[model samples]
Structure formats: C-alpha cells, structure tokens
Target: MTRRTSKLDRRLVAETALRLLNEVGLEGLTLRAIAHELDVKAPALYWHFKDKQALLDEMATEMMRRMAADTAAPPSDDWRDTFRTRMHGLRAHLLRYRDGAKVYSGTTFTDTSYADGMEENLRVLVVAGFTPRAAARAWLTAYSFTIGYVIEEQAMGPDPFAGTEGYDVEARAQRLAAYPLSAEAGREMFQDHERGFDEGIGAIIAGVEATLLRRGA
Candidate 1:
C-alpha cells in the first residue's frame, strides 16, 4: 500500500492528531495512531514530529489556536467582562475533545513553535495595566482553573446527579436521604456548570484586581 502521506508537515500531523484525540482521547492518542489518520507510515510522521510529546505540543497548540479563532470578545470593552467571556469560551473549547484539558496541560507552549497562541491572552491583560508578571499570572490562573474545572467536568460524564434521572429515582432519593441540603446543593451546582465556572472566574478576576491591579504590586 502507498504511504498515505501527502507531503506531511507539522500542520497536517497536528490536525490529524487533534481529530484522533477527540475520538480516542489522550491516553489512546499516539504517534502511530496519528500516522494512521494521516494515511502515512508512522515514521513519516517523525519528519514532522520527532516523538509523541512533540506531536502533543503541536496538538495543544492547534487546540489553543482554534480556540483563539473561535472565541470572540464580549460586546462591551470592559476588561473584566471581556476576560470572563474569554474564560467561558476557553472552558467550552477545552471540553471540545476527550481529555482535552489533559492534553493541553502537557504542552510546552513554546513562543517560536507550532500553534503558540498565548501572546494575545497575555497582551490583553498587560494592556489593561497589569504588570507583565501579573498579566501572565492572571491568565495562567484563569487558564489553570478552566483546565482543572473541565477535568472534573468531563469525569462527571453523564447524569452527574445520578438519581435525578427517572430510572434511578428511588436509588437517588435513598442515597440523599436525611441530607436534603446536600442533595439540593448538588442539584443546583451540577445542573449549571457555566454558572459555577463563571462564579469561580469572577472570584479569581476580582481577587486579582483587588490585590494586584489596585495595589499596583
């Protein structure tokens, strides 16, 4: 059989790896698997990515690049509000593929390499009067939270509030027996993760503003 590659480059390899990632998840994602997706021999991929980690870095870059392309600033120019919108969009983007956050966490995010997209993120904060260090910290803090949040979100999978469904109604009720508030809180919290993420982001942004931007430290 002909090697499936059509002059494979880093972009093609990364894009193919991304699709495989969504289908098979991070653990299942391998260089060989990406090579198969690219219709090329595994070794053909090495001409573009030296190893799985290199491929992963490129994949992470692609994911972040796509998110930057997809994410739009909020209607208003208020930095905090715009930041919130971006954070929300970031969470949604990270959740696009299976174990997306896990893959992202592993990337080197090199400035001179494939799919490096953190510049705009840092620029926004720094332009808003954040010291370079503070801006990096702010973006990283929000990004880290989003990653951690999505890890939990994906793990929760289907029917997070298990007993809420009709089939498990009885079991759910019994499990929550004598703990009405716990059941109520779970339902409220899990039912609307967007709100929870927003709240957490709001807290982080607010804290940063109060402590860093205000104090000018």
Candidate 2:
C-alpha cells in the first residue's frame, strides 16, 4: 500500500469541512470526518486548527467569503432596501447547506475579511440619517431576525424550496384540528417560508424606522 500525501492548510481544511457539513450536518460533523475527507490523519488537522471550534470558525469565514463573492449587484443606497436585500440573500445563502445557520451562529470569524462589507452596510445606514448607535442596533436587529429565521427554515428539513414533503402541513393541520386558525396556520408557517421571511423582515425594518429612527429624528 502507498501512503497518501496531501498539502494541508486552514483554507483547505475549512473548505473540506464545509462540503462535508451538507452531508453529515453540524451534529455528525467531526474533526476525524474532516480528516477522513481530506485523506489525512485526524492529528494532521490539528496543525492547522486547534480544535473543532477553531475549525467551525474557519468554516463560517469561508461561508461568508462565498456569500460576498456571489453577491455581484451593487448594494442599494436606501437603508431599508439594503437591509432587505442583504437579509434575503443571507437566508438563501444559509439555506444552501444543511445546518448552515448553526455553523454560522456563535462562531467567531477567523479573520476580518467580513469587515469591509460590514463597514459599507453601516455607512449606508449612517448616510441615511441613522446615528451610529442606531445603525448598529438596526443592523443587529435585522441580522438576528435573518439568522433565526434561517435556523427555523433549515430545520424544516432537506428540501430548501417551498412545498417540501418533509414537513407535513396537512398532518399538522389535523393535529391542530380543534383550532381552525391554528390548523390553517400550518400552511402559512410551513408551506412558504419565503413569504413569511419577506413579511417579517419588512415589518422589522419598518418598525426600526418608525420607532428608532423617527424618535431620533
């Protein structure tokens, strides 16, 4: 038998880990699995990543890198439009992989590669008359909403598109048969998440303007 030799670095390790994530998900993902995918020993990964958390951080950074690269259109100047576009894009990005939101959540970015885009976002809000603090709050609010929404969205199962058979709306309605509205709500909640996300984010951005920006103005 011949020994397999491969060059290892943070990028390769992280990228490999990300590809495996769609198959194994966050729970099943392990350092050994990543090593196995790379055809290297588990110990070899440690030279690049101190632990699984470090590896996760890199995976998240790579996800963000891909998202940034994929976004070709120029960002809108209006703060609300900018946020709406970003949040929608984020949901789509996270939905691309199983448990993508989980991978992103709570992982400290391995580097400042995300800073420039972030800076531009904040600048847009500030230019639109948001005080710096208010801009941060508004961005955070929209961000939290997007992340949380995608977490639930991904939880619906493997099918990212609307009308995924994995989630049984009729069964849910039957389960809630005693309560008609609650029963009907299954279709709304489960059938089309895209619609819910759009409405929810619009309300959030509008609420921010009405409450925070207006009061400040």
Candidate 3:
C-alpha cells in the first residue's frame, strides 16, 4: 500500500526542491535529487508533484507568489516610482536563485493571487491618467521587457566580459573593424550592462508616458 502525504510532506518537498534548484540549477533539478535532499525516495516526491515539469511549475509559481507578497503593498502616490520599485524587487528576487528568470519565464499564472497583483498594477497606471487599454498594454510591455532583460542578464552570467577581460581598446578595435560603429562604442559598452538596463527601462517608461499623453491630446 502507498503512504499518504501530509501537508507538511508537500511543503517539505517543495522547499527541498527550491533549495536543490539553488544548488544545482534547473538542468540539474530532478525528483530523485529532491527526494535525496529530503532523505526520502523518488516516489515520495511524486505524491506531491507528478514529474519534474510539475515541480518546476510549482516552484515557478511559488517564486511569483513571493514576488506578489514582496511587492504587494506599495506606498500610495507616485505610480512611476511604485512600478520601478516593483521591477527592482522582482529583479532582486530572481537573482536570489540560480537560473531563476529561466524558471519564471517558463511558467504562466492565471491564479487569483497573481491576477490581483496584475489588477493593482493596472489600477496604478489608470490612476496615473492612462486609458484602461493603454494601461494594460503598458503593463504587458514593461513586464515583457523586465522578463527578457533578466533572462539575458542571467544568461550572460556574473562576468559578462569573461572572455574579453584582457582585450584592450586596440584589440577590440581590430576585432570589430568590420563593424566600425559598434566597435567605436568602446569596451565600456561591454562593461556596463546594468547602465544599459537602466537606460532601456527609463526609455520604456518615457515612451509609455508619451503615448498616454498623446492619446489624451
């Protein structure tokens, strides 16, 4: 006879899986690994999640749930600042785990909890004078940019210039001689991705605001 799992067992399995994900990353995460981490057999994990994908989905949702909680209670006024702070918080949370963005981007949430967060974001945008449709579009665009940026940022790894660390200006110039404009931008371009991210995010917000204003006009 199979043993029934308690709520505690399910929570342990999920928490254990999260820890394993942090240690081994998405590629290395498996039911067997999670079970071993919990000092239980693989079947014990199946009692909670049917397979690796199911576990991954649960983990991804849990991450979003945390994000919703962390960013849920924003301060009143200054919607722009509120949105920016939320994005920053989301980025910080994703950075906490290995390949976190990869896992988050793979899953979708239509649950009430996530929907409430989305509704709140839209409400903020609408209160800032955006039409409902524009508010929705802006939220979706900002979300897409945030997710895409985080995935690329994480994939680029801790040291983006890992292979090009020793390459001097002249060496870089020679390497990019074929693409003069891109080459002329300098090694600083390769060194400061965070600045690029900030600039891009700023531009997105500005563009959305401009669209809203133009629509009103």
lDDT of 1 by residue, 1-217 (tens): 2245466778777877777676777778888777677676788777777788888788887886777677654435466876787788878787777777788885785345323345665666667788888887777788788889887766655422232222333455579889887756666555467788888999999988987777545
lDDT by residue for model 3 (96-210), tens: 7877888888675524557777778788878778888888787777777877877766665562223224235567788989999878876554445567767777888889888
**Per-candidate clashes, comma-separated:** 1, 0, 0
TM-score of each: 0.77, 0.92, 0.80
CA lDDT, candidate 3, residue 59? 78
Ranking by lDDT: 2, 1, 3
lDDT to native, each model: 0.71, 0.84, 0.71
Best TM-score goes to which candidate? 2
Off by over 4 Å in 2: 1-6, 158-164
Worst-scoring 10-residue span by lDDT in model 1: 159-168
List per-candidate RMSD values in Å.
4.6, 2.8, 4.7
RMSD of 3: 4.7
Q: What is the lDDT of residue 149 in candidate 3?
A: 79
TM-score for candidate 3, residues paired by index: 0.80
